[model samples]
Target: MTGLHERHLAVSPDWLALYYRHPLELTHGEGRHVWDADGNRYLDFFGGILTTMTAHALPEVTKAVSEQAGRIIHSSTLYLNRPMVELAERVAALSGIPDARVFFTTSGTEANDTALLLATAHRGSNQILAMRNSYHGRSFSAVSITGNRSWSTTSLSPLQTLYVHGGVRTRGPYAELSDERFIKACVADLEDLLGHTRGVAALIAEPVQGVGGFTAPPDGLYAAFREVLDRHGILWISDEVQTGWGRTGDHFWGWQAHASSGPPDILTFAKGIGNGMSIGGVVARADVMNCLDANSISTFGGSPVTMAAGLANLSYLLEHDLQGNARRVGGLLIERLRAVGAGSPAVREVRGRGLMIGIELVRPGTDEADPDRAAAVLEAARAGGLLIGKGGGHNTSVLRIAPPLSLTVAEAEEGAEILGQALHTAT
Candidate 1:
């Protein structure tokens, strides 16, 4: 097959530059690997921003999508579909919420928008509280709550106060706060913000900050926040767009990491739910979802094909015990990475749970700045047949290694070896 780079060079339009993409064009993918248009193979540790938890081109998902496409692709929301109902039931059952009701959307952004709307509707309030360095989505309402200004340019109106504190950083005004102090401060901030504002509607946050460099906050953070929200009569929204569906190894739902506390009033999930089929959902408490009228609908949210794909994906995950694999393999990978970092001056920190891992790189000086050597390390890794991602505020120089759950031990070791080689080469 001809490479997309070659074809683009010959005939592609100039508008393609609007988006930043890898120079290589992928032609196909299977399991934990992808082939460039030129047939060069590369191990995919990135996993489409951690969306392909079960891996690319899964057999069962492909068969389900094909069969459903043959039967029916889409229908108006005014009509009911068997596949949609079945998928919803399975999701509710797996999520441990027997009376859960689902509202589907085509992407995580839409799912977030739906969740925010539902929360505001239930409380009839406009004020929302969110954590700093947290990412919900890119839509108008979702972006309004996002703490990153790079992703959003529109000036936030007075109605929204995107809280910007209590994340993983050693410097700044928040540096004085320890993990426990930070959690307490977050709760205090929410309470103070809600004091003057009557009828504060909801508070939304990611269980583990993803785009903010996979930072996991202190333990009991969720429970403390949940308590504050309950006291103020506000809904707690869990944005599981990246952490949901077994990527976090220890639990099926990333929020389960905080099971000692209480569950969120509303949960939004996407990324891996449809195994790359572009499906997302808002799973809310039965009472909260009941406020929506029967007339509320999405034209293509729960189409038969996407529903079938979702069912097949979930079934495969359960049958193969991919979540167990994620936990075991991810633990092994983290141990090895930590060992590698033990003696390396360039590595500032290693953090993550399950398959979601990040390695923070720091310079040799006392400035505590991101080491450009880490960027060179990633370039070297790509040249050495491995692909990784960089993230965090300074682009904090993290090597994001979130491979498919189906990735084998041998493949994981090989990728790590290449990363080691890349690190040495860059140094």
Candidate 2:
């Protein structure tokens, strides 16, 4: 039989990243644990890059998908769809925008693309402002705005993007400032840039900068920017693909931490709403959402199957108060991981909130990032029966941990124990 590795190499793109020196094929999962093709059980820390919002193979989501499939899987957006309407209503209510309208897509990339279109069209400008370490998605427009060179594949883009400061709090020019000073400095920088630029459609940002190693600005940085943008009649678009649906613990949406006047003009989300089904969407105010004049349709955007799955998954999350669960469990997990990293010289910083956490690895006793050491820790953790992820703009030297919202205390301890061992051995 052909090996999985050989088969993938023959078909998958070379840029497709895989974890570990020897990747394990996960066959199944339950709660926070997953089993490999060889039946080896391991604690899943990353949750498919935070896609599994609830738990693996969650019964509620599964039942909803099957039941919907039994009835009828899909009908184009041109027709009235009950499940889509229900999911849309729920998302709009949670979006924190008044008179919000929701538009579903097949993936986060599409959701972001739709948002960019709306912002540029509504503001009548093709110019966008993006953060230095922010990542929106992988589509052409998304990549064009992505600040990480490793993720941005080309210089060709339909929109002209201007880079901004203060996405990554530490290791930047203003890293040494107090939190209050940092916010003030970033706001001043944005104001300065706006004065020099023209046709600035909006400032698009990731509240947590997911692929940029989960880094975020001070709590109210965006709030200050909101004030400046409002003066210039610019829009704000929060790319919440990794920070939405209560993943951040303290707030339902990541922007809530930075909210001053109101919610963003547009919000894009994906990765967890369907709990595994491919469902992405954008929520915006009525005026902004209705800015487009031409007719539009999405054949697979909110197909009954995925919408049913999303409705069920969201219901389960709210009913169980998983947001509260993420707050409590993620708080404990962060403290545990911080304790584990306390003595490790290679561990530069441990940061993040809720279930989304990042451990930046650097040379022992120095500030230089150590990608090699980070990779070694990842593989060592796998050997120790715990699977994690690595990412960063600094040569990809950050260890990312974003388990499902339902992560239990016991699993957190177990994963921390193994991770501690892995860090010690690898360092």
Specify the highest-lDDT model's number. 2
Q: Report the C-alpha lDDT of model 1 over 214-309, residue by residue, as the tens digit.
A: 877776778877787788788888889888888888988877877766678888988888888988999888989887665687898998899999
lDDT by residue (1-427, candidate 2, tens digit) is 3399878888999999878767778899998889999989988998888998999999989999999999998888989999999999999999989999999999999999999999999999999999997788889999999999778899999999999998999979899999999989998999899989987999999999898999999899999999999999999999999999999899989999987757999999999898889999999999999999998999999999999999999999999988898899889999999999997988889999999999999999899989999999999999999988888999889999999999999998898899999999998
* Cα RMSDs, all models: 2.9, 1.1
TM, every model: 0.91, 0.98
Would you give me the overall lDDT of model 1?
0.79
Give the alpha-carbon lDDT of every model.
0.79, 0.92
In model 1, the worst 10-residue window by lDDT is 13-22
Q: What's the TM for model 2? A: 0.98
